[model samples]
Target: MSFTVLLEFQLKDGVENAPEILREVLAQTGAFAGNEGLEVLIDDDDASKLIVVEKWASVDARNAYVAWRATPEGRTVSAS
Candidate 1:
């Protein structure tokens, strides 16, 4: 089955490097094989906050991505 992944992030105070981060994230997502697509939306109340949404073609694909994100770096990324 297909799956959708939604990631919400709040940038640290004065973290004005959203563009660079977005580029990096986009690169990572693109490098992955199972990404159906991705969408990034800015929060209306906080410009520094964003939501990254992804669509996958199957649960296997989504699960693989989740597994990838659950690594040490993923834990760090998910923590804050």
Candidate 2:
């Protein structure tokens, strides 16, 4: 079956830079091989809460992507 991943980021009090951070993060993540698409959603009641919805082609694809993210190379690139 197709896989969906939901990543939620809860910001600390008064952190006002989520847009910039999301732009960078989404760009990198959306470029992954298995990513069918990505969407960023904001909480209706709280501006500080954000959710990233990722659609993957398949469960294998999603698992592979998650495994790659644990590698040193993935860590380095993701930190940029």
Candidate 3:
């Protein structure tokens, strides 16, 4: 079965063009193993609020991806 993950983000003040930044950052997420698709939703009333919808092939696949994101390599990517 497919698995879905929803991540919400609240951008700090003076963070310009959040959607563009999120698109760039989430490129890696879309390319990650078992990733089926990804979508970003911005709140109508609050532009600072964003939600990331991630679809994965399975629960195990999602767990594996999360585990990998905790590693040094993943941390490096996240830091970029």
Candidate 4:
């Protein structure tokens, strides 16, 4: 069965470069394997709040992506 994920993020205080940082991070994630469909949105009521929606073919695919990120030997996603 297909799986969907909705991730919520709040921009750090005084993050003027929030958009650029988000875009780069998303680009990197989408470029990775097992990422099928991805979309990001901002709350109309709160611009600093962001949501990322992803649709994957299966739960395994989604788990694979998470595992890839969790490993010390794997890609090191920026954490700022």
TM-scores for candidates 1 onward, in order: 0.70, 0.74, 0.80, 0.77
Tens digits of per-residue lDDT for model 3 on 1-80? 99789999888777566556676668878988899999889899998898999999998888887887788866522222
Q: Give the clashing pairs for model 2.
A: none
Which order, best to worst by lDDT? 3, 4, 2, 1
- Top-scoring candidate (TM-score): 3
Return the lDDT, model 3, position 48. Answer: 81
- The alpha-carbon deviation from the true structure for residue 30 of candidate 3, after best TM-score superposition, in angstroms, is 0.5
lDDT of each: 0.74, 0.77, 0.81, 0.78
Candidate 3 lDDT (Cα, whole model)?
0.81
Q: Tens-digit lDDT track for model 1 on 1-80?
A: 66788889877775566567667767777567788888889988887788988888888877776788678764322212
Per-residue alpha-carbon lDDT of candidate 2 for residues 1-80, written as tens digits (9 for 90 to 100): 67788999876765466566667667867898878999978999997788989999998888887787788855522222
TM-score-based ranking, best first? 3, 4, 2, 1
Better of 2 and 3 by TM-score: 3
Candidate 2 matches the true fold with a TM-score of: 0.74
On the 0 to 100 scale, the lDDT of residue 21 in model 4 is 70
Better of 3 and 4 by lDDT: 3
Which stretches of candidate 2 lie above 4 Å from their native place?
Answer: 14-18, 76-80
Top candidate on lDDT is 3
